[model samples]
Target chain A: MDRKMSPETRSALEKLADWFRARSIWMLHYCTGCGAVELPPSMTSRFDMERFGIGPMATPRQADVLLITGYLATKTLRRVIYTYEQMQTPKYVIGFGSCTINGGIYYDSYNVITRLDLYLPVDIYIAGCMPRPEAILTAFNKLREMIEKGEANGWKRYEENKEWYRANQLKALNGEVYVTR
Target chain B: MNLKELISELKNKYRVLDEKFNDPNHTFVSIVPDQLHAALGELKSYGWKHLSTISCVDWIDDNEFELVYHLWNWDSRSQISLKTRISRSNPHFPTIMHIFPTAKYYERDIHEFFGVEFDGNSEMEPLFLEFWDDIPPMRKDFDPLKYSREKFGERDYKVPFADFIVEEGDQK
Candidate 1:
């Protein structure tokens, strides 16, 4: 007997899952640059990030979203990959500043990885050198909407194309060259 | 004694290549590399004890590395920048760790960036760049842009005209 779920039933189940995911979001933010400063104001009484049911978590394993605050230097990117992999499925990556989008002022930096999307699947990007608390609130609201619509599928994308992302990471990180004067 | 008297005494001992009073409080004294250590020691004895910073300037045209040792006198409330030019081919300078212990980190920084070896400092390993595997980045010969391109692959950029809105007056 072939027991296949009907189209309507499957769609309804997905919508329920999306609703639950949208309501409870645990974030692990790596404060690598100046953009980390804006978070304190937003998370505090002034902006109140907790109102959206999005709160910070210490460990990656307990988190659903990885918040990359700013620039990912070659070294920090290595650690980020380790943390990202440790996270459970249905994970999201929120790229915080212009640094994560295109390396910001460190665009010409030898060690700074420019385009973050090449390495990690970014669910949402809040642009600006350091996006204000208001902008941060707006971006989070947009992210929730994306979640509700079953659109924030970065973790699924990561799973589907794991090999390509790994190759890019290795190319950027693993190398031993001649260091001379 | 005073700054003038101290510099006059130093002129009698060391080869003063050039001397300039840049500002009311800042004085620069350029000297040969051979007498750098001895001159610095005498200056320390004359209450010029504070080591402000150690900086390096690459003179690729002259094929030399200029090492500047910035010192401060608390009593006189003035700064003295002792400058010395060393051969670029054999870029080595004696560490002034005996006079200024904090110079260890500064020497290591200079060693990492400029490829200038501080002979007396045993900890010659990198200070800032931990896993750096390239030529001294601060040198004029080492092209940072080329190095960055080689190490970090850039994005294949194209014009995204669809995202832009040109104003009617600006278009003309």
Candidate 2:
């Protein structure tokens, strides 16, 4: 007996899944740089990010979002790749501050990487040296909106362009990052 | 013994090339590389018991490497910087671990950054910089900008307008 559901019913179920995913987002509590200073206020009663169902998770296994807070040195980038690979699918990456966009003040630094998008797929970027708590909340709201509309699909893009990202990672990290999975 | 007596005793005992008193509490004594071990041991016996740190500087033009060992006397609050120079091409200095056992990590740090071989220190392995392939970065001749550009590429931008707009007065 064929137990396949109708196309309309499948689409409705997917819409419900997107709605749940957009509401509850568990961000990894990993601070890469100085940009992490703003997160305390955002998570506290002053801004109250929990009302929107976004909270910090201790482990990447339960996290839906990975926030690259600031500039990533060559050594840290390897660890960041390992962390990103450990995350389950449907994961989203938010590149915080101008450091992830270009290199910010560390443009000419020998150890700091210039661009983050070359290695990982970034869904949205918050532009500032160190964005305030309000800006961070605004970015979270925008990310929720994107998820609701099914527009933020960086995880899918990562799977499709795995080889290209791997090449860029090897080039920057001197072929040291080993992805166990 | 006071600073004056200490300086005279060091001069009479070891090969003290030059001595300069920065202030009453601080002093710098330059010595040959061969006399570093003996001088440091004597200084330790003279109540300068603390070996604060060991720092290295690359004198590229002179083709020499200057190693400064800062020793502190807690009793009198006086500090002495024992300085020594070794040939840049063949930089090797005996490890001061016998006199100051804490110098093992400092020697490893100097070896990692400046490429100076500290004899008798078996653990000269890299303290930092994982999988470092190029020359020592702290050396003056190693261009950091070139290395960064070659390994990690720069970002490209396409301007919507002209490359440069020159004002009438600013034009050469």
Candidate 3:
């Protein structure tokens, strides 16, 4: 799965995949923090994320993107990993706030993980404490652009760097040492 | 009952150590640790039926943990905070589940956060902070920043922001 494809084959296949992925984005809304409140406005009448074909899915299996809406604690991050891995291939992760980027005000918090990317591959980051609904809409548009360009290969990055990502996950979650002991 | 009548009644029945009125509707009373159960029992018997919550404050400097049992009298429309100080080294307190059955959860929370053992509360398992392996997190000595640094890796900024600042017209 990690093998590199020739440029011609890669381009042809990715072009078709990207075209379909750009229009319809099924999101797994695993909201674990305060930023979840901002999503309602974005999905509702005023913003209408569905207008761009971005809609929430109940389970990760059906989703194309995983939307991590806020700060992830060590406990919740475990569940996030399970959800991320369950997502179908060519999946993307939209890290929702400064919390996902650098932990926001929870930077020194003992429970919250400082970065989202260390555990799962992130395709786009919406930068705010709790990003406004408009910012979320903009982020979704940017993600669509990335998808169309075939530049958002976070799922592939995860496939290639599984060992690195897993090691970081173990270190963050206290590793096999905690599991065994 | 009026606030003065209630205070005077409390004074007449038991030795009140210290009393402070924060407002017309709220009062705080501090008593010895030994008197906690009895005091709460007495208050519960006297129409102070509401157990708002049981909270603990770690007085690390004084080597004590102050347990505050907040009670409310719905009829009188007033609140009373009953306080008692227990030794920090051996922080154990009796369960007042008989007086307030809801105290079971409160005791569990106190046990989880402050490491205070509540005797008779057999279901003193963790209420929050599941699978926590370290010292009770709410203690004054538990440095959360140090814990966070040791656990969650902070991002290393390769280019410090100050170094990237551009002076006026320097871009040209």
State the DockQ of every prediction: 0.43, 0.55, 0.50
C-alpha root-mean-square deviation, candidate 3: 4.7
Ranking by DockQ: 2, 3, 1
Q: Taking the tens digit of each residue's C-alpha lDDT, what string does model 1 give over B89-121?
A: 999889999989989999999999999999999
Where is model 1 more than 4 Å wrong at Cα?
A1-15, A174-181, B156-172
Q: CA lDDT of each candidate?
A: 0.86, 0.88, 0.86
Write the number of the candidate with greater lDDT, choosing between 1 and 2: 2
* Clashes by residue pair, model 3: none
Candidate 1 backbone collisions, by pair: none
Worst 10 residues of 3 chain B by lDDT: B125-134
Model 2 lDDT tens row, A25-95: 99984588899999999999899999999999988899999999999998888888888889997899999
Candidate 2 at residue B156, lDDT? 88
lDDT of 2: 0.88
**Candidate 3 on A1-181: residue-level lDDT in tens?**
3333333445777788888899999998888888889888888999899999999889889999999989998878888898888888989999998899888899988789988888898989999988999999888899998888767888888988989989988877766413322
lDDT of 3 by residue, B1-172 (tens): 7777878877777678888999999999888888778888888888899999999999999999999999999998999998889999998888999889999999999999999999999898877564687899999999988888777778876657887889989987
- Which structure is stronger by TM-score: 1 or 2? 2
Query: Which order, best to worst by lDDT?
Result: 2, 3, 1
Per-residue lDDT tens digits of candidate 2, residues B1-172? 7988899988988889999999999999999889888889988998999999999989999999999999999998999999999999988888999889999999999999999999999899888676787888899889878887787777786656655877779889
Q: Pick the candidate with the highest lDDT.
A: 2
For residues A6-79, write the lDDT of model 1, one tens digit per residue. 33443777889889999988899999889889999999999999999999999999998899999998888888
Q: How does each model score on TM-score? A: 0.85, 0.89, 0.88
